[model samples]
Target: MSAHDQLLVVIDPVARRIDGESVRIAKDVLCAGAAAKICLPDGPEEFSRALTRRGGRRPVVVGDDHALLRAVAALYRGRELGDEPLSLVPVGSVASVELARSLGVPTGAVAAARTVLDGVARPLDLLADDSDGVVLGDLCIPAEAAAAASVLHPASVWDTCRSLVRTLVRPAPPAPAPRAHRLRVEADGVLLSDLDDPVEDVRVRAGDGAAEVTVTHPRHTGAEPLRTLAKVVTVSGPGFRYRADTLDVGPVRHRTWTLRPKGWALTLPPAGPPE
Candidate 1:
């Protein structure tokens, strides 16, 4: 088949700059010099079903960051990434800066499509949860994020507030909280830290083959957050909550995760020179 043949484009209706005109421009550019067509979605569920029914065609997403996350989640839910490429053009206000920054997608929709048509696959990583939720980006454990968790299932005013306040609030300073969870973390048989004593939260990250786990004391204000690369990280606690990207995921008792390299690749806009 030709480069653009059998390509399926799915866009998020709510994504920024996603009106018909921008999408048509992407269709023109991505299919230039080849044969292709773009399909619009009524909503996320239809988009997911459309992807599942698409046979052998590569799937491309034309939406903002949340849309991209939804697409990725759909692929995982449908189990279609074993032999397909997932491309994206961030078309919403909250662009996939972190995803695009990592993948090198340009901001211009046309340029982003060019990357897709070129068919390059980079070794990417995905985080898989015990509940089968796979995250391609950051996970959060903010003090006030819990309020948002309660209304995660169906859209509610409380959940809406939880989502709104998180990105708006400045990262809280580190101040110890009165309550803490006693726990133990082991990395490849090495006992990294044993907080049988008491601590607020713990983080176990898997990037390389090794693991990095951190346990923090209970503070009213959380300290500077830690980002790391490890192969596998596990967490076991009494009762806790966390957020992955924009999705509120847990109150999980025991959860473990690791990076799935080359799990999926996205087409990104090019980057400008660093400051």
Candidate 2:
């Protein structure tokens, strides 16, 4: 295969040093064989447009976890407009290590590029907020250190350190007792939990409903509390604050959020024929 048969690529400039290098190497490898056009985006907006306009062209990303998140954002922004599959070449430090490993991307740049060029297209699930902010992965809301989190990225080293400290060593003060809110929370019209009483370390999540919803409370001694997957979660506060994935938005008086699955066609290393 040659670069001409491959998809276009967009590399993030700020995606850690190693990621940039890996992207360069991946570009060379992808282009050498497929004749793919590589377009290094100056910013997120341009990348979104390129992805939207070039639906026939597979778009590959070269960056850290955030780079992939940016691409996901663009995909959601153009969800109704296009359905081109996405490819990624992970090039970051520890942050991208998990995503790369999970996706079966090789550690070596050339190997990862080969995977991208040889991968398959599959639909991936995503979570979306009311404001259209999408969470590609997990979302955590801490009760103890909410203040510190406001200052830094949710996944940042500082936040991680603080989380560890609060969880392991010196625990921070719990969030002020939950106040009475005039909102109702229901899942499939079934009452799961209500906030009339002051609650601490509350969590709500959506899942396959095969089992129970996982909830982790602050300063809990051993077991993390669990709840069932509800169709809806309604939150009402004077000003409610919630973290969706990596982005934060809200403080609205009353808002209802539901867990809905979104499909995204993604390009991965082509799968082998079934035995």
Q: Residue-wise lDDT of candidate 1 within 1-275, one digit each (tens)?
A: 75445678777777524466667777788677355556777887887887787776778878766777787787787677656667776564434445555445665666677767764655466777666677666654433322222334676898788867985896864554345555554444455445464555555443443444555655554554333445666666665677776677667666667667667755433343112
lDDT of 2: 0.59
The best candidate in terms of TM-score = 1
Candidate 1 has what TM-score? 0.71
Residue 106 lDDT (model 2): 57
Once all C-alphas are superposed, what RMSD does model 2 give against the true structure? 9.4
- lDDT, candidates in the order shown: 0.62, 0.59
Q: Where in model 2 is the C-alpha error above 4 Å?
A: 1-4, 16-19, 80-82, 103-107, 146-185, 202-212, 216-224, 231-234, 250-257, 260-262, 270-275
For 168-245, candidate 2 gives per-residue lDDT tens digits of: 877666665433233334544665435553334444443443112334333333444646665455555455566654
Worst 10 residues of 2 by lDDT: 209-218
Per-residue lDDT value at 60 in model 1: 81
The CA lDDT at 143 in model 2 is: 41
Error of 1 at 91 (Å): 0.7
